[model samples]
Target: MLISVQALRALAAWVVVCHHFMQIFFDFHATGPIGQFFTDKGAVGVDIFFVISGLVIYLSTQNKDMPAGRFMVNRIIRIVPAYWLYTAAMGLLILVAQPLMPHAAIDWTHFILSLLFIPSENPGGYGMYPTLNVGWTLNYEMLFYLLFSLVFLFEQRHRPLIVAAALFAVSEVLTRLGVISHFYRNDIVYEFLLGIAIGVFHRRGWIANGLWLPLLAIVGGLLTIYHLAPSDRLLHWGLPSAVIVLACVSLEPYFQGNRLLKVLGDCSYSVYLLHVLVLYGGWLAATRYGLNPYAVFAVCVPLIALGGWCSYQWIEKGLYLRLKDWLDKRRNDGELKALSRQEY
Candidate 1:
């Protein structure tokens, strides 16, 4: 994996965290120009994530012929364990702290769906969100994985084109039929296609090497995103995200990953999952003291990052290693059984 991508992942998680921080500390609807920019646009981090997901997944499997089952297993191991643990933990927190924290009414159906990463309308009429609201992105991630896995059934050299064609056909048909509004059918899926395109370009040595070109793309993309109204569709966010990603990967030769960025990237998933709780807790404490908003932000952002790092070490990495060991043991046991049968 490209080291820069990991750093980018950490940057994306923090952007979302900062956006939520703005919401918790101020009148969310009444932000000034700069504050409004962060609040309105911070969620674009999700767009960046989708693009990265496409690029990374495609690149990871582009040259190697992987079994669909193995692909699914690796993806599940990376995503499910940490997500379910956090979902359950947060649910318990909501139940215990109901009076102290404002939470949506628990709908058992949606709760179950959220646990399974199924797309469903949030129980409390908050639109299409899971019990752990940020997990709506995971639903998309899982869906993308499922869709991308289909390409593995085909030849390795052709998988990229096959996946792109399948996505294009599906996205176009779904949009034309007016089914795109459904949670599962949203056009946002196309953003992954954009990422796949970039991955293919990079793999084929088609990306331009000139530094000026990427810089121009990056600047132009930002300007477009800046001018976009809050309600714009996938193109508004996805295109700029694609541009930024394209530029980053093209200029990868000039980039070097430092310890701080590497750490953040390693913990990016933990950071994304845990930041909400940390920031909310900080909000509760800071509000009681009538602290300056800026001071509250200054204190809370670092706390959130620290919380994420600790969680990564204690929770995410620990569980992941344990799960991997168990899976490995199971595979070894099966191999031994097969060997014994053959010897007999």
Candidate 2:
């Protein structure tokens, strides 16, 4: 049985929620250890999410005969449907709540850019616009998917690793040379490449024995914390992120059964997609009711988790599985037809 990477995904989502909560409630510019820490670390969750995405995607494709079209279709089906639903829901919510929150204006241009998964050129903003901050990561993810698909389409399996590595190197060099803006050249592709490397290692049985693996993971985590720049924290942590990933995959079955963790993992994607709304909504409710931030989290976390679970059960799982099954069947049928035609 494969280890569930859901736990890592869930953890990353919660971390981001916590980071956002701190940002919204606490004064990050305040003079204190806690304030400084929160300010410095708010984006760590995003990094974790990137690493996890890379690892999961790599694992999904390992040892599988995934054609380019099939791979692209599978990825789009997994991500786009839920993302579009959330985007529409958030867009509508923003519209309805705009009267109450006068600052919640929609920029049609930015909204269109977001729909295309393109990062907006608007300065000092998370995405093309500021409607939803979490949407920026989705933009990066979509870009990575497009690039990954293109590479898979034209390059043979043997060449993909080199091509991906070269792409990463070029992007990095461009960023360092100031040819590309830091915002545009941020190191996400490298993280994805690191994930692919981990997948390759797993396939080659090069991952070391139990204790050494965890130890390396711990070291990688430390390196991530130390070497990660404020803007590139998440990207820097990719290796450590992979180490943690390997550890989890190695240890998942031995844990036998932690129903709670497993359940959280199962609802992880929903948690990630919905937590921003929960955090924002919780903050608004708390402010209106004069509740403490920690108190807000207390109520919000469980409610968000429950919401995530419901979304997973009612939306993501149903749609993803059905779509995947339909695609697989279609692929199989096409293959059979081709074979029959050749025989005739």
List per-prediction Cα lDDT, in the order shown: 0.79, 0.67
Tens-place lDDT digits, model 2, residues 1-344: 23345666677677776666676666345356655655666566666667667666766655566566767777788777777777777678777666655545566786676676766654333334434657778766765666666555443466446547655755677657876445547665567666666667766777644655675776777567655665554445656676677776665555456677777777777777777777767767787889887788788889888998988877787888998899789878999999999999
Model 1 local distance difference test score: 0.79
Model 2 Cα shift for residue 187 (angstroms): 1.6
In TM-score terms, candidate 1 sits at: 0.90
Model 1 / residue 49 / CA error / Å: 0.6
At residue 168, candidate 2 shows an lDDT of 72
Where in model 1 is the C-alpha error above 4 Å?
A: 100-103, 165-181, 230-232
Clashing pairs in 1: none
Clashing pairs in 2: 47-234, 120-128
Candidate 1: Cα lDDT at 101: 61
Model 1 scores worst on lDDT over the 10 consecutive residues at 178-187
lDDT of 1 by residue, 193-270 (tens): 888888889888998766888889889988888889546557898889898888878777666656776788888888
